[model samples]
Target: MITYRLLHPEILAGLAAAGHGAQVLIADALYPHSTGVPAPAARVHLNLRPGLVAARDVLEVVADTVHIEAAVYMADADGGESEPVREYRGLLGSHRHGGDQEVAWSGLERTDFYAACRRPDVCMLVATGETRPYANLLLRIGVP
Candidate 1:
């Protein structure tokens, strides 16, 4: 039996198919899941209802399931960190890959973030029900 928090078959298959440097986007309810990512990217919809699942919740499980090399957040309009970003940072901080190597962190404007997600390198896109604005996150998968 699978022993980790991430048990979704499609998610596991997608992650298994993705190699290092592949990106995964865990987006909020407000995100445009259908068109946000490229057509080749695998889609996993966890947005059961309004606030049924959260971007942070998906991030937590994904983080634990794979080795994350970097993290990118959608910056607030004012270029300041949003509340969801702060919460995500805390969660990412608790997970590590390749010993003490720190996960590279960065941010981009809303448009730029969407552009990044549309890139071919993104292997999977997860749509969550998080209601917080600017709660989108893009994670880079790393080697185990």
Candidate 2:
């Protein structure tokens, strides 16, 4: 009965179970889904093949499903953002929160980013087949 594109039952159930400040990761093809997140977290694989079910695709649908307060992505050493980051920025621009009322677009070092993924707060980890490098994204769930 939902109008949104996210129709998967498992994904909907996982999102419904998580609370405010919880995180959801949209992992790329190279991401270590099996070993990265904790066993308690839900790992939903949408990675059918390379270039299919991209991280951005999951992000767009999940955005419609929940209120995202902040989003984080891996940044390069030189401080330049990737195309995927730019694409995600466009998607997050409308949803703002906190005092500044702006969606936090944070950048983390590669190793640190993976470390963040393993946290217990990561309630849902969507494994995508995005082929681009650094296409991973971490979304912080916000209060409704």
Candidate 3:
């Protein structure tokens, strides 16, 4: 048996195929998984029901498994920090992104967020059952 908490076969396979600089999105229930992202990207649906599986939970496991270089969250419409964004910021607090060692984090505008996630660099999108608004998050994989 695998010792890692990330036991999902599809998740393992998708992450294995992706390399450094490849993006992974832990999307909330409201985020568009199909049309918002590229057609070739791997999709994992953990959204069995509302609040059953949080985007934060997925993010935690993914962070443990991969070296994250960057983090981007969909900004709240009111220009205030949402619950998930706060949690994400705290969780990804220490990661030094890219070759420059900069804190690779951004709160993206609504339309811009969708566009960034749609790029071919995204390898997988994990659709969670989180109910909170503006909880979608994007991450860039770093080198081992």
- The prediction achieving the highest TM-score against the true structure is 1
Residue 107 shift from truth in candidate 3, angstroms: 1.2
Residue 28 error for model 3, in Å? Answer: 0.4
TM-scores, each model vs. reference: 0.96, 0.92, 0.92
lDDT of 3 by residue, 1-144 (tens): 899899999989989998989999899999887887899999999999999699888888888788888888888998666889999888777554454564478888889999999999999999999999999998999975
**Collision count for each candidate, in order:** 0, 0, 0
The candidate that wins on lDDT is 1
Q: Residue 34 of candidate 2: its Cα lDDT?
A: 97
Summing lDDT over every window of 10 consecutive residues in candidate 2, give the lowest-scoring window: 94-103
lDDT scores in order: 0.92, 0.87, 0.87
Candidate 1 lDDT tens digits, 1-144? 988788999999999999989999999999999999999999999999999788888888888889999999999999978999999899899788887887889999999999999999998999999998999999999875
TM-score of 1: 0.96
lDDT of 3 at 75: 89
The C-alpha stretches of model 2 lying farther than 4 A from their native spots are 1-3, 97-100
Which residue pairs does candidate 1 place in steric collision? none
| C-alpha lDDT of candidate 3 relative to the true structure | 0.87
68 Cα displacement, candidate 3 (Å): 0.3
Best-to-worst ranking by TM-score: 1, 2, 3
